[model samples]
Target chain A: MSGGRDRGPDRGRRRGHSLHAFRAILAKDLRVELRTLQSVPAMALFGVTTFVLFRYGLDRTKLSGGLAAGVLLATVLFAAILAINRLFVAERDEGGFDAIRLAPVDGTALGGAKAAALIVYLVVLEAITLPVFALFFLDSWAGLAPVAGVLALADVGLAATGVLVSAIAANSRARDLLVPLVLLPLLIPVMIAAANAAEPLLAAQGPAYGGIGKWVGVLALYDMTFIAVGFAVYDFLLED
Target chain B: MKVPSLRALSIATILCLGAGFTLVFFYAPLDADQGFVQKIFYLHVPLAICSLAGFMIAGVHAIRHLRSGDPVHDARSYVSIHLSVIFGVGVLLTGSIWAHASWGRWWVWDEPTLVSFLIVFLLYATYYPLRYAIEDRDRQARYASVFAITAGAFVPLNFLAVRMAQSLVHPRVFATTSGGLPGSMLFTFLVCLAGMALLWTCLVCFELAAKSASAKLSRLRRALEGETYAAPNRSRIAPSVPSRAASPLT
Candidate 1:
């Protein structure tokens, strides 16, 4: 059955709210995650630890330009991968996919829900990590706001890709290893665009908008492509 | 369902390869810029183009596989990617040799084309392990198709991202202007490209034919040997060709 968007008078009366299904699934995930305190806190802790490691590894008191962007975005992306790996675990082990298949709602709801949930985790990730990164390295908070904007765009793409990849790996034997192995290469463009966009913003001189537009455009393109892809292929990936 | 016979394809391949090589070394004029070393372009560029093309072809086949649930399409898709990865190895080696010859380094991050190709290669490289990690044959084919399609879509976008990140800092190694390639060099490059494309197609056919034969042989063995016969390897990653005599699930 087509998702709620295409239902008509002749098509059927039993069709409405793929949106409702998406919301319910997303709410369930968020509630479970909140109650258990599983993913975000660990990801936040990982982010703080990574920033500490970067401080020692780069051996710089303050950071800017490519270095700051690399350290910050890479940390967020890796932490996103952590969340991504576990995204479909409960579904796989607990027959959530069967529930989705049995429901009247469209299968894309699961992917949409998962991507929405992952984006939430990423936003929370940036919230915790950005302040710590600023305290540890940034001389001014001026660049932080723009970096967050670039990161938000990157997160959409990451979430779309992460959901699709997580679904694929979730059924496999080595789900943990397969997630990063398959995901990191896919995330390279995100890294390239996000890091480039953030670089000028993170410049040692202070925030600059110069050339940020191009990278943002790239991030937007990457997000649109993956979202469209995940939406189109979600049904097939969820098939019995 | 029908393919050109192996003899015809091999003959065509040999002829094109021979003529392409001859034209590259003899007929094509020396580059005014890089000179002798530029000849590697005929080899490297074609290999890169064919390899990328093969990947997109695999994606197309994957789309059909997902839609039709045909293991034949999956087999075709698998062989296309398998051959492309092999060709990718050639692309990297030739590209590296060219880089070394021209830039005096085996690897350079500055060249966006090289870097993009490496990223594409790296992404597709995971196809094997992804297939191996899934034990169920049908699920493996299904997931592998998803990977192929996603990675295929990624190729052009990855190039765009890598190119934008570099911002044309790469020394234009090919031609300064869009149509600037001289007629003679263009002719030779076309020949080599055609040859490489033929070689790729020929390899795909060879691999598919080999896989089909082996699948048929196994099916025959099971029929003759009956219940006592065991599959040689239950954990094989490659898709077993679904011949008309055999059910796809088998």
Candidate 2:
């Protein structure tokens, strides 16, 4: 970080640096993740564990309709925290993050690629969990759609934030515990959408004239707001 | 960038307090709904708006830092955010007390007002940890700026999201429910907003003065440390900084 020489040419080299940097980071995370497949399995395990808990405690015998929405939202939220914690920490433990930062590159684009990989992993984790959640807890697909949209958009905000926090966690004590301490409080926006959207949809209320639209709007606003914030901050977090 | 003198700010504080209290106690009419409890609106809304405004200033300075690579601007922006977090808590405590008075509940998730304050509380709470977890000064400033800006958007959106949800636990007949208001309430609200902004301007100047003084103190201390500390001209940074203490908040 301290020793690099600043060369004369400004225009061409900087562009090439950005492109190369993005690809390098993307490839590195992908290869490491593909070989070990750590995030997916740990996330899947978390999803399964949540489902098992839901199934064991309230699997129809003890459950009521009013509590269904609240329970499902809690389920997705638990999966999210597990997935985020697993996905971010492993990148540093494997030295993938250090390589990306040490490389001469556009840190934001590198951050962009990391976000992309994270989103892909998250989507797959969600997929694995969806059937499990649907089979055990939720009634149908309608509720899952809005809830999924909320999770997806929230995923970007979380993962973009994950990049910043992951960097901080790397240099801190017990990075694992620190991630959630910093990350969970930021979940207020997510909590509102997931809980609200889940309740109406689980009751099969999606057919209303424009009911789901409001929840969708909430999710979209969260996405747009955080994406802009992430872009502005990514470069700074990468200054090494 | 303009700063009111400390004496002037002190005078302004006295005037705003006198006007705010007089208006609330005597001039403002009792609400058709929540009664005098609604008067809490005079304090809660203005504090929330001011804190949000502070966060926005931090975001703007973050832009300057990212664009021009100016650490001083980064420091100034962080100072604004620091005050914002403190004021944001003031907003939360007032809102919570108002909720207890009006709704007969200390905390409820569905009330947009309660939910909004919780969001403000939680988001700003994250700022300190984010600052403390990092070893890099510039990185802390930058990430905290991103957080400060995101907070600007998140605060309002969270308010809206909680409101849009079905079966709200807290309902208010405040101006937000209806677009505009009676002339007097609107006038009172505007005066409060302007007063709070002025208060923030004064706070920022004070913080900057303290920060500059502290920076000078650190430099002087290092200079006196002599052979133990490297000279500033030749030292680009405190290289390989270990056992160094960082601020709890960025």
Question: For candidate 1, lDDT tens digit of each residue in B1-250?
Answer: 3344666777899999899999999999998878999999999899999999999999998999999998888888888899899999998999999889888999989889999999999999999999999988998999999999999999999999998877564545465666668889889999999999999888787777777777888889999999998878643898887554121111
- How many residue pairs clash per model? 0, 0
TM-score of chain B of 1: 0.91
Docking quality level of the chain pair in candidate 2: medium
Against the hidden true structure, what lDDT does model 1 obtain? Answer: 0.89
TM-score of chain A of each: 0.95, 0.80
Candidate 1: list runs displaced more than 4 Å.
A1-15, B1-4, B167-178, B244-250
> Residues A65-93, candidate 1, lDDT per residue (tens digit)?
99999999999989998899999999988
| Model-by-model DockQ, in order | 0.85, 0.52
For candidate 2, write residues A1-240 as lDDT tens digits.
233455445545876888887787778778888999877778778777876786667656233233665665566566666656655565567766576677667667767777778787878887788667667655456656655665677677667666655655655544677677766666666766655655555664442223656666677677776667677666666565
Top-DockQ structure, candidate number: 1
